[model samples]
Target: MPAAALKPKPLPTQSTAKRPVQLDLPYAPVAKRPLPAGRPREWYVTHNRRLKAMRLAIALLDSGVYVPNQARNETIRSTARRIGVHPPSDTTCHMVRALMRYTR
Candidate 1:
């Protein structure tokens, strides 16, 4: 058989990203946001609300699949990305970690 005839057809292009077969990384980087001091109570409250929304979204992710299997950190990151922000507050991550721990 000729080599050219034996070659397989090229595959179609993909719109969705392919999951990597493997990943290597050191510890995940902590996300930090510095809110200015001397702000009003309303600012604080709104900040809390936004962070709570983020937490709720994470909690709701994968229909509440247990954290470790849900790839919780990545899930949180993508949720934040979709909202066009990093994790809103230090407490947000801390709260998520605590919730995951309690759930497990």
Candidate 2:
């Protein structure tokens, strides 16, 4: 077979028409309220297990009725479970500590 025969034929082109482009009208800006200081917007937006644990911890601390038992890990796990969050782990404890630090 010849090289010319092996080459593919060019595709046919359709006629192009010029049409008017419509631009969207700009709307007026609305005033927005600012988020509270020291707390992150992500904390409210994302409901991750760790954040839930942290929120629970903060609420317990603020209530002034939460007392730690001999087993700290057990207490954390029980509190998390009561609040419908994931079982407490090292990461959850770390998140609670970080949240405590920020609030202080």
Best by TM-score: 2
**Residue by residue across 51-74, what tens digits does model 1's lDDT show?**
665464554454554564454565
Worst ten-residue run, lDDT, model 2? 12-21
Q: After superposition, how far is residue 99 of candidate 1 from its true place, in Å?
A: 20
Q: Against the unseen true structure, what C-alpha lDDT does each candidate score?
A: 0.60, 0.60
Error of 2 at 97 (Å): 1.6
Model 1 residue 85 CA deviation in Å: 20
Q: Which pairs clash (backbone N, Cα, C closer than 3 Å) in model 1?
A: none
- Residue 39 in model 2: shift from native, Å? 22
TM-score of every candidate: 0.33, 0.39
| Regions of candidate 2 where Cα sits further than 4 Å from its true position | 1-50, 62-71
